[model samples]
Target: MGEVTINNIQKDESGILKENKKINALEDSVENVEVDGEKYDLTIDGYINMQESEEYTLFLRKSTSGDNYVLTNALLSKYPVEEEEQDELFLEDGESLEETEDLKDTYQELYQEVLKE
Candidate 1:
């Protein structure tokens, strides 16, 4: 697996309130994202292993401990980026990527939010 530098996003006051709104209905929408760092530990699920030199599109979230990052889910989160093998969804089954629209949307949107920092 290649190393990808992560950039952390600190929440603004509005962002924090947005999170609270989810639990208390304080905001109409959620726009905040979890922070990341250049280097941190990775917590992976045992269903598959990441290999060196392979390109992947991974969706990661900060763990509750606020230290290491969590791979969103085992199969659905780690996407192999090889153009030829793009047809393959996952090694085994749970749900296809297309089926996880909300997750993809969450990560995609969060990623964009992070980039704004």
Candidate 2:
């Protein structure tokens, strides 16, 4: 545990700033973790869901926040996704190699589009 900083803050309402009893509290909730004689701050950046399973997921942050490099329980991580895998059409068993290649290309294009956004 670390120290907490309390600062006076003003509230904003409809473009107007008013001084109120609000306090901006900054708490150092981060824990210090040690590995191989070295200590590190275990800060939570964020989390990510498993690509294909809703019950499984991963944290996308640094090597801290408990089990850093492992797939954590979705519920424990507090960032579970309702759906893990994106809906994708499967190629038929008898599909030609060219068709499969075309499908791959299409998937790549859609993935790129999503990344752009």
**Most TM-score-accurate candidate:** 1
Residue 100, candidate 2: alpha-carbon lDDT: 49
Deviating ranges (above 4 Å) for candidate 2: 1-96
* Angstrom error at residue 74, model 2: 24
Task: Please give each candidate's TM-score.
Answer: 0.34, 0.21
RMSD of 2: 17.0
Instruction: Give one digit per residue, the lDDT tens place, for model 1 in 1-117.
Output: 223432322343334222212121011112223447344233321133555566555565545654344555643555445532322332334454564555555545544543453
Residues 32-113 of candidate 2: C-alpha lDDT, one tens digit per residue: 4678988764433221222222321122222254422322331132222232232332213343467446654564455455
What is the C-alpha RMSD, rounded to one decimal, of candidate 1? 14.4
lDDT of 1 at 93: 40
Error of 1 at 46 (Å): 7.8
